[model samples]
Target: MLNYLGDKKDERMKMRNRYRKSTALRCDAGSRCLISVVIGSLMGCILLLNLYSAIRPADEIGQHIHLRTSHHLHFPELEEVEEENIQIPPPRKRSPRATKRRPKKTTTLIDEFLDEDSQIRHKFFPDQKTSIDPMITGNDSMFYYPGRVWLDTEGNPIQAHGGGVLFDERSETYYWYGEYKDGPTYHAHKKGAARVDIIGVGCYSSKDLWTWKNEGIVLTAEETDETHDLHKSNVLERPKVIYNSRTRKYVMWMHIDDVNYTKASVGVAISDYPTGPFDYLYSKRPHGCDSRDMTIFKDDDGTAYLIYSSEDNSELHVGSLSEDYLDVTNVARRILIGQHREAPALFKHQGTYYMVTSGCTGWAPNEALTHAAESIMGPWETMGNPCMGGNKMFRLATFFSQSTFVLPVPSYPNLFIFMADRWNPADLRDSRYLWLPLMVGGLVDEPLDYNFGFPLWSRVSIYWHRKWRLPQGWNSLK
Candidate 1:
């Protein structure tokens, strides 16, 4: 009887341990759900608060706050007569040769953006007077003029085009690293498309996220070495950096190919500093699969992963990096197979992974799709275009741009910064950057692969704005 009792007690102990483990997992799941709710709620509150403030009467807000009285105004009071508001310049007439070739349709934001002579071009690429000058104050503070030539602290247009942002905790500064294309844009071969001499990766540093300081070329292209992968005649685009703690190195992975883009491999570089004269290690097809338009993501736990469009841009492959982040581990899984997607930018929120990708259109705007997965791997769901607002044309054109990065705002949970490249095939170097507010909330409009009838994640939306700024005090919160 004692032996039988002991056996029963052992069984009970095992059951208790199992029960405890199950409870812990349940609690974790519950915490994740709570986090999602809290994030969604906070975003909703911010949106409502902003809307209220926008609609609230200016007098009402003034009534609540105390104002200092002075006989001689220290700051100039509103001038009674603002001579008739500055008149908008008239639109320029299109060349007869151009009009004769093709009739102009109703002008679009894209048309204005593309037309070098459009009256609205000034609005998109503002004059030096309105550039992101560090000396500028008021409404211009922390404002990003997407597509406009952004100048560094030295009063020169920043060269980091097609870039990515990396926030370095070690330096407490955000580094914007990208291609420094300062060469003439021209076609390579007789039939080849527009190309430019590989200029190298540029780096810029910023504390307030507005005024940037040029850090010079971190990785310069080989000029004389024709066999070199980074030879100036070759192609290099979309350079992204992520710090690896285990290796204690800043690693950069970029698209490296020839003039015709036949060498479809990712080139890896390593540097001890963020401003890198990175040592070019090697280039290879990740998992022996062709990679193009890729980005690396570092998880919260210090595990860096690579996501690249592979199989001739038919699908995307994702895999965790080796502990050192130098090589892709043997284990890799193909996600979004046969999807024909490229220009991938990924972000995670509320324990759910989201990716924004553009269709494989060469240098033209196309509809963007947002994909979601419970895990970062298989069984992804394709929701419709995430763009909202603006006229139908703007939404369809993705605000006239292509996906490059989805930057999470530290202060606002659901709010994210959507960065895209507005390529000008005519002048590759003249391509512009598009940064807009992206929010992940509201009901998922479509079905998931496995969750047939259930809505598993919130709908991702990138709102189009002629001009917009982050919510006030957002930086302070961060």
Candidate 2:
């Protein structure tokens, strides 16, 4: 009986051992299967990632095509880049006074442009005899000779420098307003930059933009009132005008400062007519901040805003004006902080607001940068310079001009006249106007972060041209 019981025990032990071996085999097989599944999933995922990477660039191109189709037409002539290969002559000897005033970065071409004794002075600042005389331009009536003297209907050179053009619906005429710097240029102090005394804002009237008629001084200076903001010893620059429909008034805003630019403020003026004897109002710091190099932009919905360089010219301030377009409404926001930019030119295209600004080099020209925003008030994004078509130097120096205003073409979308001041520091009265075709479309080479490095804003291109004209039938088309 004991031997039998012992044999039963051994049999039970053998059965237990067999069960344990089978369970171990099953667990090993399951582990192998899970490993295989994980490897397969990883391989498939890698293949999918590779395919996506390969197709994404083409998809981006397709998206660009889709965008272009939505924006409508493509204008090649407006973007045609006229290459300027100006032979930069060798630097000439300068006197102690010249070297002390002019910095080392002053290129030979800039020297020529600024030199009163330069042999090629006429090349940059052409004499009045070769002016685009509207009286004699019978066949060449509409042609624009850029950088040359532009004459008005009364046989006088147009005095509108740093100008903005306004199309009046009531009178069916375009009124151009700007600084009338027809006075002599001189430095106020030994360290001061070249400037002209306050000569008031000049107004010009035009049916065709090419043929402007002088509308006399719309806003004059305060000659007797020495403490007044518009005093002749003070500074007035970059005068911009907008029509207020509710008030039926023409409102103007300008940068008001002292000779040393210490009293930085914005002056306001208003008139009952487009060709106005605008009443000079007081000057004040918009939003109670120092304002300089300023411009006022009126929106489509009658909301007007002021944009100016503030904080001792270290940044920019933007704020909305009141209902009457005379005062700030406390709806203010600062933008482009730490970017030392001035000479702002603001315009909107297809629901996007754009501004062109230059470096603060006083009268000397510098590179231009374009900032964009969806709203007029806050969070502006810089998208690089808008200048194109010139050589490296010309583009770097903004075609040797500073931005003043961007005049939209009423007849065509995405086409604008980029009005700039080719400041003749030696003679402010001889300052030339640089109006070029500004196009606001096309994909830029530099990719932005949003939309997967796609173009967030349309490229702002200010094409360089030696001579050009408005598109055919531009005025008539409107």
The model with the greatest lDDT is 2
Runs in model 2 deviating more than 4 A are 1-71, 91-107, 448-452
Give candidate 1's total backbone clashes.
0
- Please provide TM-scores, in order, for all candidate models, with all chains considered together: 0.75, 0.83
Model 1: per-residue lDDT, tens digit, 338-457? 579998898988777899999997776778999987777645678879987655656777767899888877666777889888776666666667787787765556665433243546
Compose the digit string of candidate 2's lDDT tens values, residues 1-478.
Answer: 2221245457446544643434233347659888778869997997787588557887785577557546545577667888876676666777989889975675667667667788777777878887898777566777777788888989888998877888898988888999999898889889998999998999998887888899999999989989888889899998989999999999999988999888899989999998889998888887768888988898889899998998778888788899999887767776776689988899999888999999998888889998888888756777887888878878888988999999888768778889998888888998988889898876665543222243456888898888777877676337
- Model 2 TM: 0.83
Q: Pick the TM-score winner.
A: 2
Q: What is the C-alpha lDDT of each candidate?
A: 0.75, 0.82
Candidate 1 Cα outliers beyond 4 Å, as residue runs:
1-130, 449-451, 475-478
